[model samples]
Target chain A: MGKNKKENRRNFLSMLGTAALGGAILSPVLSKAANTALSSNVTEIKNFEGRIEDFLGGDYTNIKLRMQDDVRRAMKKPAKERKWAMAIDLRKCVGCNACTVACISENALPPGIVYRPVIKDEIGTYPNVSKRNTPKPCMHCENPPCTDVCPVGATFKREDGIVVVDYEACIGCRYCMTACPYEHRMFDFGEHYSDGLPAVAAYDERPSFEYEKEWTRENKHDSPIGNVRKCTFCAHRLEEGLLPECVTTCIGGANYFGDLNDPDSVIAKVVSKLNVSVLKEEFGTEPKVFYIT
Target chain B: MKKIFYILWAVAFILGIIGVGMRLMYGHEPAAYGSRVVWGLWVAMYIYFIGLSAGAFLLSSLVYVFNIKIFEKVGKLALITALVTLICALLSIWFDLGHMWRAYEVITRPNLPSSMMAWMIWLYSAYFILLIFETLYAFRIDSGKYSGEELNRLKKRLKILASIGIPLAIAFHGGVGALFGVVSANPMWHSALTPIFFLVGAVASGSALFTAIFAFFWKNKDSEYFNQMIQILAKIVLVSVLFDLLLEWAELSIALWMGTPAHTAGYRAMLFGDYWYVFWIFHLLLGVIIPVWLLATKGKKPIAIGWASLLVALTFLGVRLNIVIPGLINPRVPGEALAYIHPRLSFHYFPSLMEWLVALFIFALGIGLFFIGNKIFKLTEDTENKAL
Candidate 1:
């Protein structure tokens, strides 16, 4: 309690400083304004302007240096602090793929491609059948089977416990797809976010030749294609200091996000209080996502 | 007469190049194969080629190791074909990867638990070195300059290396089969017979494809050596197919008759299900019944025999397609939609034009290289001119 109070005071102080500076200097990449408070206390905002100029090479005279400042501040927090994790309350989940939808909209995933899904099982049969839904994500496992068997290291668990893919490095062998037991992974197959896509909602909805899906669409290949993708735990959003879209938007309130390493974190507390169990526990994958049955 | 054939080869080569460029410009997703059907043409083609190589090597080993003089003429061609098919097989796997560049990391990382990782590194490397030495020994024996002592020394060494390949051939093809077999999630491919199935296909496809090449080249040329080799090859292909058929019946019968849920789910999806036509019509009839009948018939006309050989080669493709596709399309877990039950499934897919083109390029390259090997190593008995 005392440690949290101290940390809270420190966070409040920096939150004020960041607001005063209009968050221009700090990237706000840290989760929930907490880690940045502890680590970024030194180097006053005025001095940070120097760092920002060096980053921009003094050429941002017309534009607000705040943009670079935000990126820089984000860069300061360690990779661990940059990523936010989600914990699903399996008990709260009603087997509806609401989190799947939230993930689709948030990441602009291609059609038939989902970032996360609820695995439904009807254990037992006929008269006494009981249906249970196990919501699954990447698992972000420490000893990930997909990573172990990738042959290319395309899917690698980042230093901060978040598993990430260097899509460019991936060869589309989908070997990782086979290795994953939970079936949390999926291949892109050059598919796009089609069928029920909200194309109008996109900010910079250009043909992304880099990803190949958009290129296939622009060139109009019947295959909704390019590379391979699955749930990334909303990596881009985490880089910008936001709850994963699935966590924020889940109507069931089945999702919670916080640092698992931190004992007082909501996610940490949930696991501690609920005696969480990871799916395929015997697999020894050390999956970061904990489910409360 | 050979000059005219070269012109046709040049045209095919140009078209193959265009196909590769087209694949790069677009991508592989648009091909008429779904994610479940991911390893359709190219993967099957790869196994076909690998089978040919392994089969040819084993046949060549009979002459080298077992002192069989009757098959001497084909011994060298068999080794070279092995090299060509192996190269084609590697290309198929390379193109299938999600990130094409990091393929070498498989070699560097070396995860021992994964058999694919180990086979991916060892089999190709071992095959390459063996091929080089085998080619050298063949030419050394043919040169007529080497003394009896030197010939014996080289032959002894080649025999030792050749012995290693017999095991490698079984392990390599069996390992590839094991890759699919070990995936117990899909009961269709989960039996102990899966690897045995792959081995049988390797022998049948490998022997048949070799016969196809032999007949195509020997049709115009009067090479008694090649003709005799084809007769021997015909016997091999016919017998291998029977073993392959027996295994298929065993695998299917147990799955269908026993009536376990997993077996029933997989059998229904494959046998009397959506892929029923492919299973019964393509694999059972074309891959098995008809081709075996053609090879077994005693009608003995040369043109008729050549047709049978071509059919065997064509049927191998069907067998490979059936092996890879059936397991993938059927969801391992029943009661869920295709997406939900399938692990690591997202999109329903068929390979695009790009995928087909890249696969074509690989296939053409294999055939082209085989032709070149035939030219260089006296794969045919042409004395006037050689690839050198």
Candidate 2:
């Protein structure tokens, strides 16, 4: 339990400078990433958890984790509705590019790379067909090819059906990029945000999954660069009680995010009822992103 | 003539040095062949030099190991040439490693399945040691004419050790071929037969080395003995290239028949994909089949043999490129476009001025030092006392 608390403290520390998260977030995060966080010894757990609890003083602090009731509600939603999924309704998309802009601002990504883009394709050969714009983001595959060839397990498939990269464990070989047929992976190669590259280059300095913005700012050295990158399904927001920025700003609701496992979930209903499919199913990557045919 | 020759040599040296230096300092752009093409030009060069070095070393061994007097005339030159090319081969790999500083860690923290990585460290060290011993032994055997019992015993012992070195030399280089062949990830190269292919190519290239350099040296010598050496070398070249082609055809034939997705795609790529032109025209016609025919039929004609030798040398360079580049271009899975482009000199690569200067300085610097080293040791093969 203490091991989890330490991670929560670390996660909590990354959140210090952000505006207050209001209420309803603390109990469960402490239960999840921190419960098994301690070294095995009972004495060790007592000392460490006591040290952290003392550091936090009394309870009633606001963290950016999900409220317990929210998680339970999400779980209770029928299998079709509760599990997460994303739909890019190409028909409804106007190509306004707001989703692309929102993903960039939210990720605080470096220049020369972007998490999403509207790729324009033309169908007709000789004045017959029309032009269509499609947005490209990470597929967050069920059998994510990037996770398959990661030699050191740095890029992994999480319990929530998302593939995430543990940047610290990354060896910087960039073998994952070659494995990905989608060409989603990018190498950082010492990139930075303009002249202030080194000054604010640390991941801890950016918005992270933590309790307060100030603590996160002070402890921003935890996430490193000179590694591979990709869209993370906005996992940090998934932890907070908000929908991903792209999904919220998608004006057309051309994009949807909900549990695929839950039958009553919006994602499940659309996938089962609508004639939807995924890109490159022939490659057997089992991409999580659903597209209405 | 000496001044003109030095100028030409200097120009080549400068180009290589500048190419090397540019890669080190500028830290290479992503599109400069992309990280996927890491084994491109430099790796091709490395294998090329290694083949040359092994060829020269093995040729020199024939005289010492078998006590062949007819081949003794160029023994010292052969040994030194081997050493130079070995160093050149190492420089190719050094330039290739992206984490060049951590190169030593590959040895210290070894991943044993990475056969190329392991063999690289081992054979380089072994080849260096063998060259030193062989050079000193060559000098000592020559001294036996002046001295008495001590020198003759030393010559006998050195010959015995050199005989053992013959097989080790073969293994050292053949193991290098195994490095690429064993990688299942690369369908174009993966095969149990690759090591044998490498061995035969080494011999073919090695024989051609004798023919080319021998012709250069023969210009200043009496023609009788020179012609004799050329005859023997031509035979070696003819047989080796023929055998190598047979083996390659077998591998390709098997790959064609397998019809598995990866194997068939790789075969199609070599025979008909983008790589088809280079494979059919540049490497096969120029590198193997045509030169084998030329060497077999016209070897005694010095001009023919000379042209054939140079063609063979250039062809082997093409072969090295094909081996590394084609394998990388194999699509990772079925129906996907290959991620890597075949490495070329002109793409995003201009051997930066420094890269040219530094690689030139390295090669020329090594060659110049080697020349001085021979002069210091007086490494002549005139050991009449150790009679043929």
Candidate with the greatest TM-score versus the true structure: 1
Error of 2 at A228 (Å): 7.6
TM-score, every prediction: 0.72, 0.62
Q: Which candidate is the best by DockQ?
A: 1
Tens digits of lDDT, candidate 1, B1-388: 8898677667666776776666555455444554444456666666767766777777778777786776666677777777778888777776665545556766665455654645645666677677778778777777767666776787777778777878877887787787667654456766899888888877877777667666676533456655566677778778887887888788878878968775666566667655577677876787667776777784244454556767766667667766666556554333334324332252233455565666667767777887777766666663421111
lDDT of 2 by residue, A36-88 (tens): 44333223324222232233223444211212223345655443344456777
- DockQ of every model listed? 0.16, 0.05
Over 4 Å off in model 1, which ranges?
A1-87, A90-98, A101-112, A118-135, A140-144, A153-169, A189-228, A232-243, A257-293, B1-15, B32-38, B113-115, B219-230, B299-305, B332-350, B382-388
The fraction of correct interface contacts reproduced by each prediction comes to: 0.29, 0.00
lDDT of 2 at A234: 74
State residue A105's C-alpha deviation in candidate 1, in Å: 5.3
Those runs of model 2 whose alpha carbons end farther than 4 Å from true positions after fitting are A1-293, B64-69, B113-116, B143-168, B256-281, B330-388
